[model samples]
Target: MGFRFRDVLTSWAVPSLADLLLAALVVRPYLLPGGLDELLSDASVGMHIRTGDLIRSAGSLPHTDPFSFALPGKEWFAWEWLTELSLSLLHSWFGLAAIALAAVVLMTATSALVLRNSLRRGESAFLGLLLVMVGFQTSMNHALARPHLITWLFLALSVTIVERERRGPWRGFWLLIPLAALWANLHGGFAILPVYLAVVCTGLGLEAIWNRTSWRGVWRMVACGLAVGAATVVNPYGIGLHQHLIEFVSSPWAIQMIEEYHPPSPSLGEPFYWFAALGALAGLTAVSALRRRGVSDALVCLFFLISACKSARHIPLFVIAVTPIVAGELRWLWDVARRHGGRRSLVAIVHDMDLGLRPQFLRHSSWLPSLFLLALAFRGPLGLPSTFPEKSFPVEMVERNSATLQAGRVFSTDAWGDYLIYSGYPRQRVFIDGLQDYFGPALGNDYLEMLSGGPRTEELFRHWKFDTALVPVKQPLSRWLKARPEWRVVAETPLAVLLVKEH
Candidate 1:
């Protein structure tokens, strides 16, 4: 063993850690602290909590609750009613910090689970780190306090369970059934669960057929999956739940209103995600060719690759679900170097070469070591920014307007919805929230019209009956409002504008 070989290993180790750490740190900037969507979700949570209070006053879930966006004459999910109620109660007890802490905790725990699942399949810790880095990068765009967080966690857990045994543990699958019930109540995206489970079952079915294995395993998986699907109906909605989902999707408003439903624009804002997807696809193809192809592996890769390419937000799901499959496919590549006749000689040389290097120089834990590597990479292939903020929000404005905000309804952009909700100001009701489905096509058209300098903007405003409009200074609404005598600027800053109706 020589010092040179040890030096070589240390050099290799250092860059890998740095690459991951830099990715982690860089992705952190995308997280939303005060984005409009967060503000909306938070405000919705607050209102739902207040509505629950009113329900306690009026008795039973009121047929129509004003504090909630789920009013009559409107198509609504009320999916997050429980989460809102819970968050509202938490806000009452622990305040905004606690609610925010809850969001962070959910995100961190889900991230760790995804990482754990990735590592369980023989992936290097680096792969988990990379996947998390990519997840944060994608999810950060809409990092508001919303039910998607719960869905993301559930998806990760369900996928992990499905991987080990497609039948999934009976008890665990039943537990997930209830979680699905909760998820149905929490968010409309619970549909992903059924779809994911279907995919898993199909994978298992294919595996059974291909290997000529026992139908017992396949049948058990199919049965559990059907049971889980049935449990989704346990909610108050009954069969209306499925009907509601169908109607929601069929509605022109649903497709027109939601950004997530919109297909990806390769020309803007998602180059990295697209790059990763393309690379993963190419990598998967190479891996598939190198080994015996499995139907499930091919299907999973195709499914996620298509999904991610179709929408930017779907990137996190692809990264979470597809990365493991990619890694598994590439497992053969990891073995390639060992196949050559000189492999043993190379291994001996490498081992002997590292003998003299200090153990301190050979560190390889995770992102912590990756930090130094990131700094160097930033100047090269990584090309990440040198300094990244831990938070991606205008906290000063939030603190400054907290009291005023507590006194009124806020009309905000999609980005700041959850932040306002989490702020827990009782007087606050948001004009909109992340429940983009609730708004339907009409409101979305109106919003687009408004943002695009629509002439009927004022009429649309009167229609929604908004109290106060909080917008980024750059919005066309700011300019439009400033010219209108009916609206007065209440607060103005370089970053944002708060406008209130003139008395």
Candidate 2:
């Protein structure tokens, strides 16, 4: 097979404006309503700032969880320091909508940039970017204003930049230093950076030792990995940051207790996202091997693929890490195909297979982008009918309590923790939150028992010394409280029940 520069350009050129804009229409609304935006909405901003308060004040008091109560004198994760600081400052200066708007812009731009770069560098850019989009779709709902999103974008770009540079103008390892630094402060997921760097370095070392490659390239790769690892120490917690991440990961209770942390079970819920992820992984591996391409990088692709399939959060990383490799592989196949049959015959067969889309060079020149933006502006992120089920939260119940609740402390389920924090209860301390490990297994089990209609429900409630409790209407504690004269049901809704303890 022979490669032509024109064919490569056709495959790698930027997607047309029409295509880009249409993608925007598809992506914008999903970015808006509940997922991450809920964290920045009028409901969430106040509590987020309180988290910042704990940090800036250098105080032991926690803004969210009751587990922090026992660990009062100790350090907090501050995993979301950068985001909390940014949102805190933004809330003080302007408002939460500013942060939400910023999130939308950042997420939109990150998506566009990934697509643009993927299209600009490879012979099978369109298909590569499509796979990237599909890969991200599995984890798209969680892409909110949290620190993880910043790390997500940075990690995606870091992989792209390094992969693109493998054969291009190789820069110093210094660029990665800042990525690690910012990533460490942005989210604890920065721990994944060392794993990624190690993987790349290992691949490079294997190439040098076994494949008899240049030692120079191997040393540089190793140096870059080490430099990035050192840069993680630049954050406020210094080396202790890694300890936090290790402890968090080592916590087995979360996987056993937290739903998101649990492994995927197709029989339990939506199969589309998982299936989409699996399809992308299979497509990448088969197509890459078919082209007889970079065997070492194939291993890297496999690592991320297995990780992604095992946990839903890893889908975007797998997509970002492998998209360009797939493109390179497809490029090789295209070249081979052109040799067996002329370019004309090869193109015919490719199109017949519905293998890829043609580059819309004219898309960059159209007014279609304007229309797409207008549609986004009109439709907003909620997308009308709402993506998830409405009964997911007890909005009316929360609203009713919003007026009556003077109680400063409350107890609620871990799943509803983020929602309560976002519901403008900045001063309220939840019995639980997303930081699962901090609560310890015993308390977490007690929380479950309290909600499970167990006999120990009342005993656990008194043990926690909760001023009031907000639980599902279906909870045993709710029923017990409703029957007791000492506890009064202050508000009731199909989604949740609020009970106030009689003084």
Candidate 3:
């Protein structure tokens, strides 16, 4: 553990470029204006913390409503209880600093694994950076402090392990069995791994059929898949956890209403555009890569691509699946361009530059520890975020009307409801929050009807008996409230208005 002066100096002065990139990514969020608070933009993270805390205090997982006043005794499935417990423990131990750091590390690891996979597949260092950049493009938009990010990390590692096993001798592919158990507790995104496993096995099996190779690899994957499936049932809920997840994802009511669960559309902005473009590239390259040895790559990429297209939430998963495949094929593209006598072309120039940059990026030293220590030491100066962004959440509105929030049942968007719990939970409960699966379709329909001014809007509203409503200025409900004399605006911010109903 002793650090030699020369070792430290060499590491600092001539650090690994890969390590430097990772360090920069890890440090960026902490150094930003919001510090680690930027990750809390989702606000659902608040309830997760509350749930985790509840689990810790109660000495058991919850099976009934714990944070919602809307449905006081509704059955609940706290499937991600382990992740919540860890988040609560981290918050208690180091505040948001630990939570933020953990998230950033998962994100960084996912991208780094993608880069490493590309290099292993024959792409140069600089070329792999291209996919890494594109992967980050869409992921940052959904980069909240949640458990799903852990799945991205585990899936990346799973791909690395499976691919290595495909190439060489038994190289720890069996480890994925235990990891699957851990992943199931962390996030439902573990569900994607089974899909990935099936895709890989089918693709590799196809390759064997075409090349007349051994079926051992394919059978090995099948065995691994069964083992992984069994491991997922190791949770407290056991087999019922899988049954719950299946029903939740398949229920048209749940997935159709949630924006993230919806298919890609123009309203999603730049991330949608980038995903469309990358998705197109993945399709083209995946189908064509089969001309070489991209059998497994094509199947895996196409499956995730289809999933991401169906639900925008799957885009990061799609990105992880395809980046290495695309990077590897792009090298073949560069070679083709070279054979066509494009030596003086811009492609050639970039290729030349990549060759020159490879040595610099590959420089190995003790940069990981150096950069990690730097991140931890700078936490104080960086100013750990005390609250989420006001623009994204009703921070000021909540602060000014904290008493009203605690004194009455509130109705707001799920995100605002989450912030409410984070700010004043045990004393305050919302009519609804982000846990759509737990609330079920009837409540979801009522919520949408209430907001949209449907025929039963007033009826649902009166039935719910909401005392306070905090809504965005632009929402239809805000305008609806304004037209009614019974609802009065007590406190206002530029982005949100807090309205209380007359008793």
Candidate 4:
């Protein structure tokens, strides 16, 4: 197993296109303008980190609304506490940059695993590279620094293991068992793992019935499925986590109110374009898979396609799970076209280009690992902001009005409410924040009514005793507050306005 000169030359001197792409994927996000800031733009990261700190100090996970005066002592599920703890540790040690780096690492790991799985499935590197961009696009769309980033990595890893098991022995498939446990602790998305394994097993059983797959494979899938399912319950909440996720995902109210729960629109551009394109290609692939009794793919594709169609958040799940299938389909289509069509056509050119890429395709080098390490070392020191961007959040405004924000019963946007918690948690509380599930429709609707300057605005404000209000300066809510004789604008930034009620 000693390395020859040729091996050394190829492995050390020249990296593959995949290797370089992996490097670019990791560094580009942090290097781009406001990229690190953009990752922290979501206020949920603040919730998770603060919750982590609370858990760490108290030596237990929180079960009540710890950051909100609106719903104090409500039965709250801090289901993602493991991820929160991790984020807390990173932020505690390295500031916000570490969380950004962690996110980049998660996204990069997902992408790298997808690429490896694609190449392993005999996908042509040229086409694989192009189609895998769909996964990258999905990552960029939801690139916020949160626990779900961990889910992205786990999803890609779990799917790849399942696919490999279908083709070969259940060698590394056992990893999913412990992975399920860990994923269960990290994010609510762990529910998807058991569902995915069940889908794959069902598909394998269908293939077995058609004699396209061995019964051994089907039984192995069943064993793996049961193992993973059993392992998932080995979390802090046990089966309760599953129950909570079921209720959350099934809640029609959540579907109507939460933006991510809504179906993706094509008009949103490239993210949806890739999703729509891959979805169409997946349909064709699934149909073709049926002839060979490879119903595993058909089921997998069909299930995820519907999931993607129903929720924009599930778009990444589809992209990670189905893009390889789409890449294989593209390859099959390319091969057919090249064989039957004119020699000088686009098909012939792509075929030739793919052939040219083959030698470098398999080459491995230190570039990707080296670049990732470098990115990690430089990330914090490199232009990472100490807090959420001022342009995005009312960072300076919060500092300037700290007295009013911390001491008074404050009302603000859900996002800014989250920031308020981050800034003055264990002391100050918000009228509401982005934890819409915790708040429920009753309170969320009331908050929305307040924002709308609706009939409930006065009654709710009086009931809640909200003496301090912070909102985006340009919103009608701000103007509405300013119009009230009992309220006066104390300060205003281009991004946010602070209003205090006249006593």
Candidate 5:
């Protein structure tokens, strides 16, 4: 048989309507009124950029806290060094516009991979679209320009590969080795990779026992798990990264104090909405499990649902883990509905339209969807702001009062500290920032105490001997400092107030 154009087109997977919708949803955050820079809302991005600058300048990652005076020379792990380096390079070459565009591209690519995985599993186009829509809503809270975005993308890819391997030969298992290594350097989220592997392997082994079938891929899966575990330590910190990560995760401060670590609450409106939706979907899947369900799918969905409930940040992981399960369940539901009197329903309508499309048309038109996504990714850099949003950061205020800020030891909020470091580091080291691990339990508690104006707040002030403070105008600390006779307001803005100690 001779090679033909049709065969070539079919060999490369075509993007479906679901894939295009996912791409659009991923780019939605960047299309706000203020433009792409508005999507860079995470304060942590400032410190990430600063760290990237340091790595680029020194030609190596630093192992000591350099941005905060409170933890001067303290041992620190740049777990996100790779991500930081990328952010730094992009910001340096093309400014914040490039970073925003890069984030949109990464998120869109991640969504595309998830959509492709669902389609590859023989899920209906309607089911794929519904899953992507739900996944987007679930992950919107975490859609920021930070290293976590990198983790999300890698995790999606890793899960897709693992699922593929579970269904077929173990060819892609080896790829997880390097992916785990890269993940370790990019973010602490690398810890999830092993957990995912263990869960899948255990599910497969249990499934074999449940069905009284021979265990085919269990040994290979176990070996892949071992290899991935070994690959995780290939980062700069080696095993120390694991130690630090465990310490951070296990810390009471991290679990109780961090907003992201808290359980999903109704107080968080958008997040609560999606969390409830996922819970309802999980219930539906469980109720419909009798019709069609795999042990692995059920277990993974339960594990991720519990995780998402316990900590809001894990919502995206749950969204990713549950997509295929949701698609499978929805496919079953659609079939059931069609067999009943619901053939005239929306799902049936979509099913008819999808079935009517020719394979040749999809293969030949795949390039259009791919090109559309590429265009959406580039739209940010081409037409959006080149700098971070002024309202989000005290950019203009920092620049105008740079000399005054540099004149003294400054105490600033963790959120503001990142921006301060980004703009005025070396001359102005922070008391605290988003790198909670570097501060540890002791310093972290102290920072929180001072932030809440605890009884020891004065003691903290005396210990740090801070001569100036940059804080939000509406903060309690700012109000108290304004009332102190010993402190004078040197500069003030609607966003922040700069206070200096008076002689």
Candidate 6:
């Protein structure tokens, strides 16, 4: 088929208001003075970047934990090796700005895919865009410079591809195998791919059996699921990857103590606000209008919703899974409105808006690529920031008291341990970091007990023989240390304090 003028215009044009909005949302994070640096909220990025650097330096992935003092040489699974390598390369080439920009690009692309998939599933343009925006907004809470962002992008692509295959032939279903392989190297979340395939396949099989239709697609889906599952073991750790991830996820301490693993709470702020509102709307629509949408959509939505309820970190996954269903439900409402004269105020407003009308000039603007190139070219080196945000971390205190910190064994908060590894790794190793698996339940519980100043806190500290401590100013350990004659205050910042054992 030759490319027609209309086809060219549709392909090259600015497209719709939704496209413009998505572009804006993607670039907005990079507009601040720090650009992508502003989004580096979590200290985990430091460890990830450092891991990537180490991998590049050694020319192979490490099989043991090297960043922590608590468990040096313990077997470690660098499941996010690919993402770490990519981040390190970006940081080396364009500085942290590039790494941050990469994150924004991944998130925006995921949102764009969701929007496209919803429209492809017969949703109206406006409704699709609205639903995608909600999903994007809900995910903003966890949208830091981490491997999870890459996982989100792959998850969206996997779902779109699988859904397409479910609706049609199995021509592109095999693509999931290579995707699974790549995903396995990028993040441990690759395990979700096989589960997603299984759920969809089972749902389709049940539907076919109930309606007495051909089971050809169900068999194909089963084949695809097995292929993807096999691909997941293609990483450096091979079968060990699955075993490590299973242990981590199944850990009671990780599930209960980790903030991200905790259930979504309205008390937490914006993440919950959008999640609660959209979740209620989606649930109601699913019950009333989405019955005919098929069992697969219902199963996927319910699975993600329950997962999100169990852990707030899964909210974005839930948002991505439910967006198309919500869009389809809204499309049904729009059709009903159209049948009833389409004169409803809300319907009239959406209809009158020229969201689909592409202007002639914008149809061939095509300057975005060149503009982005120019921006990156002119964008000079990003001078490393002297300190992290004091509100979120103890950057100032760490820098001011670097000598004192390196003088002895130091015990710090889990988040602070991540920052220390990024800033002071060779000179200093941490008691604990974001790597909950490396520490396991014993050390993790010990660290938590010290932080909470439990009865065994003194005993744990004595066993570790930590002479220097860096903790939040308001934490129980910090407060208790302040009153102890054996520990003397050495340095203090607005958000953090440092103490040293009396000589």
lDDT of 5 by residue, 1-503 (tens): 35687666665666555445655677666666766666677668868887898999999988788887787766776788898998888787767766766777777777776766666554576567567777887778777888888778888898788877877776766899999998998888989989988888887787788777767787788888999999999988799889988888878776776788888888777868877987789767755652353666767777888888999999888887778777777777677877775778876776788666423222323554466446545745467556567787778888988988877788888888888888885566878888766677888888878777678988989999999998888777888788889999988889888889987
lDDT of candidate 1 at residue 288, scale 0 to 100: 80
TM-score of each: 0.71, 0.79, 0.90, 0.92, 0.91, 0.90
Report clashes for each candidate as comma-separated counts: 37, 5, 0, 0, 0, 0
Candidate 6 at 305: error in angstroms?
1.4
Give the 10-residue window scoring lowest on summed lDDT in candidate 5. 357-366
Per-residue lDDT for 182-255 in model 4, tens only? 88889888888878878888887877778854588778878888888899888888888888777877778766
Judged by lDDT relative to the true structure, which candidate is superior, 3 or 5? 3
Index of the highest-lDDT prediction: 3
lDDT of 6 by residue, 418-455 (tens): 88877775576778889876677888889989998989
Where's the lowest-lDDT run of ten residues in candidate 2? 381-390
Provide the global lDDT of candidate 6 against the true structure.
0.77
Query: Which residues of candidate 4, in runs, are more than 4 Å off?
Result: 1-15, 25-33, 338-366
Q: Quick one: ranking by lDDT, best first?
A: 3, 4, 5, 6, 2, 1
Model 2 clashing residue pairs (backbone) = 16-363, 17-363, 17-364, 36-144, 43-422
- Model 5 gets an lDDT of 0.77
Candidate 2 on 1-503: residue-level lDDT in tens?
A: 24687655654464464356545644555565454335342223344555765556664434334233423544456556776777767655544445554555556545654554555544454465565556555555455555556766787777766665576447744587788888887777777777887777676676667667676865776787788889989876787778867877778887677555555556334434554655575566645653453445766677777776676666566666666566556566666776778757956566444334534521243244454445445444524221112356666676567644435467777656655665544444566666667677887887778777688877877777776778888776778778889888877777778888888
Candidate achieving higher TM-score, 2 or 5: 5
lDDT of each: 0.59, 0.61, 0.81, 0.80, 0.77, 0.77
lDDT of 3 by residue, 1-503 (tens): 35697766776677678877866765564575666778877878778888999999989998887778878777887888889999899788776666666777778778778778877675577778777777777666677688888888998998888768878658598999999999999888888888889999899899999889999989999999999988999998899989998899889988877888888888887878888888988998887878776588888778889989899888888888788888778788877886686789887887788888766554545666655556555766766555677879888778888999888878888788888888886677888888888788888888877776577867877888888888888888888887889999998777999999998
> Which stretches in model 1 have alpha-carbon errors above 4 Å?
1-62, 68-77, 123-139, 166-175, 265-271, 274-279, 282-291, 341-425, 428-433, 458-472, 485-490, 496-503
Cα TM-score of candidate 1: 0.71
